[model samples]
Target: MVAFGFTVANAVAAWFAHYDPVNIGWRLMFAFAAVPALVQLVGFLFLPETPRYLINHGREKEAQEVLHRLYDNDKEWIAYEMGEVAREMRREAILRQESGDEFVLRRVLRTAHVRKALALGCALQMFQQLAGINTILYYTSSIIRSAGVHDKITTIWISCGISTVQAVGTILPLNLIERLGRRTLVLSSLIGVVITLCMMGGAFILINYDSSKINPAQAYIGIDMNSTNTNKELLDLCFGFRNCDECVTSEYCGYCSLKEESSSLPTTFGQCLPVNSENIQHSLYGYCKDSMNNATAYSFTDTSCKTRFTALPIVIMILYISVYSLGMGPIPWVFNAEVYPIWARGTCVALSTFTNWTFNLLMSLTYLSLSQAITKHGAFFLYAGISFIGFIIFYFFVPETRGRRIEEIERLFMSEKEITPERNQRHEKTVSASVI
Candidate 1:
């Protein structure tokens, strides 16, 4: 709520800040962010550890206290609930004993369903990172600049606003998620994302192809991969691309002159064919200057712009945030949590988390390289295509598991050859009776 509120407020502010306050935009952004961090600190002070955590460590008395605090004057009800929970725990322990399934990696890897779940979990994590969310998040200012917002203040404000919207977007589904099935939500979100991305790409293409109403110096330019100057490459790495051609000067006007022309005894008494135009060197005795200076003309432009990102880009940006939050924002974490059988839940969660980090590393490491090699639009387009592919894969192969029990969901992935009606019946009986 805070983040979304901030976004909406900032958007209003941007549309009506009176003066173009692009000068101190970044500092203003940090100031706003600090307010939330301070608020979060205050919130933490009032929050207590959950009863589940207390009970997980067998601190029944503390759990009881928590339940009492939560329910108030319902000590007997709390005690009854705790007893039932304890009985369920004991039943689960007995099941684990009977089934001989240890909550360990070795045991999890031996199960075919668990293995399939792991694959899906890993794949989801990989998809989320490869979508370039973190790269955009971390370098939002640069991304905005590349999109043509040149003024530091404008870029910072836009970045903070976008981030605030993304954070705000998280709450939308949080409120509506239970009402909608997971698969439907994910698919719907992806479709929105596909549209937003295509729009964003169109915006870039429009900016690129349009050649009216702007100074040449203010327009975006292509990076010349065949640039000869090493200095240009280094600068491009730091601040997108700069045309070295822009640095050339008129001083290098077509020629270099040799030193001491005709000064050696006046070129042997001014012989040597008097004055050959192409083969002549002229030198004077006192303070002589070369006829031409070494200079060239270079034309270049920075990719950033303050005036270009008007209302249209802002709308497209918000759409991007909405779509992102709807699907890519939450699914990875949810899938990571749900894709494992209970016995291997911990291991699966860890593996899925590792998969997320691994893909994050890949995206982080490759993002700049890809951007430098293939321009911003191409990079984002590539990500959109990959996301589309992932959407399709999820639509077909991924099971719908909105409100299903984790164990029941696991059976859906079990080896068909090993799972018969008798086996399923026994499995259901074991699960219901709290057999492992």
Candidate 2:
């Protein structure tokens, strides 16, 4: 639901950006997020405390009242539920007394079962960020622009669309978590993420390489090929020959206005070379210096140079977002909560949550710089490689928590000597009666 709310907010922002009535529309969109917090605050005022929490705090009378109200005055069920909660609380208190005043973190680290759980919890959170979903979310607009989408409104809408797809994809795992199991969904999601990232990287590579090759002659003229002192004179001649009004420099090749005006001078400087030119046949554009001192312009013929592969990156991104939302989005939270014993559950999950946000911040902060340093395609390819390594680690070390009791899960990490038969039998009975 949090993810859904964020996606909807972004969609609203995109809609406003498209029609920005007074130029403050984007600000309004950001402000829309605060509405949910206000709503939650109001709703929380009327919310009742859970029966177990009341019981745990020694408010048995209030707990009973709350449970009676919750179960529609079913006295038998409330009694049974209260007994279970009381027994669990007593067991936890006994365990705490036996363990003495040791720090929760120290205990967690010292215990074999909990240490394993902590490792898995931390690792899952780390992999979630390292997989680069946040990178895609934070930089979707920039990525759309890099994919050759030139329209500002179109890029904003496409980003909103991707978020919408992710929100919808999250529903699949909610339904499949019990049926398909965590291991299946997680493994499948990783595979899908790897494939889509590779495809996205390949698409960018193709487009960038093709665009780079379109006009090699104009690109080379001022830099390497025409190394005479007349380089400045040649650059001036190229600039003079350009008809700014008729030439669109933003396109793949700057069309020569002079060629259209008269067929006599068939060739012009910094323009796209002919399709049959030796350099053009070799897919190499000559380099020329533009008015901007450091900028290089490649020569190209006036043919339509845009590739049909322009839409491929967006398509691959949508696939990647959808796959990530399916399992990676929600399973880590569930696993983190379920892996630890009641005494350490809150502390362990908090530590894991902190790890999650820390890595999330790191990823968001470094993504743009990393992309600029290694290229966007390379960054995604790097994420794919990390995801592959993560998949292997998870398969070997992470247990399937579905259909298992918390005690059973903890015991999975313990040896036979560590788990006595009497305790196991007691846990089985507790598991049969207790609510997760």
* Error at 3, model 2, angstroms: 2.2
For model 2, residues 1-436, the per-residue Cα lDDT tens digits are 7668657866787777766635677678768778988999999998889888997778889998888778999989998888888777776766677579999899999888888889889988999999999988988877777666656677778888888898888887878999988888888888888888888879867765644232334534434445553344443333332232112222222332222334443234434321223332212223322333322223323322344566888899888988888888888998998889888998899999999999999999988678656766788899999999999999898888899977777887777776988877766655554443
> How far off is residue 256 in model 1, in Å?
26
Name the regions of candidate 1 deviating beyond 4 angstroms: 1-59, 98-103, 211-313
Q: What TM-score would you give candidate 1 relative to the actual structure?
A: 0.67
* Tens-place lDDT digits, model 1, residues 265-372: 321111001111232231111111123231111112233322344455557777787787877778777876876766677788999899889988888887766765
Model 1, CA-based lDDT: 0.60
Q: How much RMSD separates candidate 1 from the native structure?
A: 12.9
Candidate with best lDDT: 2
**Global lDDT of model 2:** 0.70
Off by over 4 Å in 2: 64-80, 212-307, 416-436
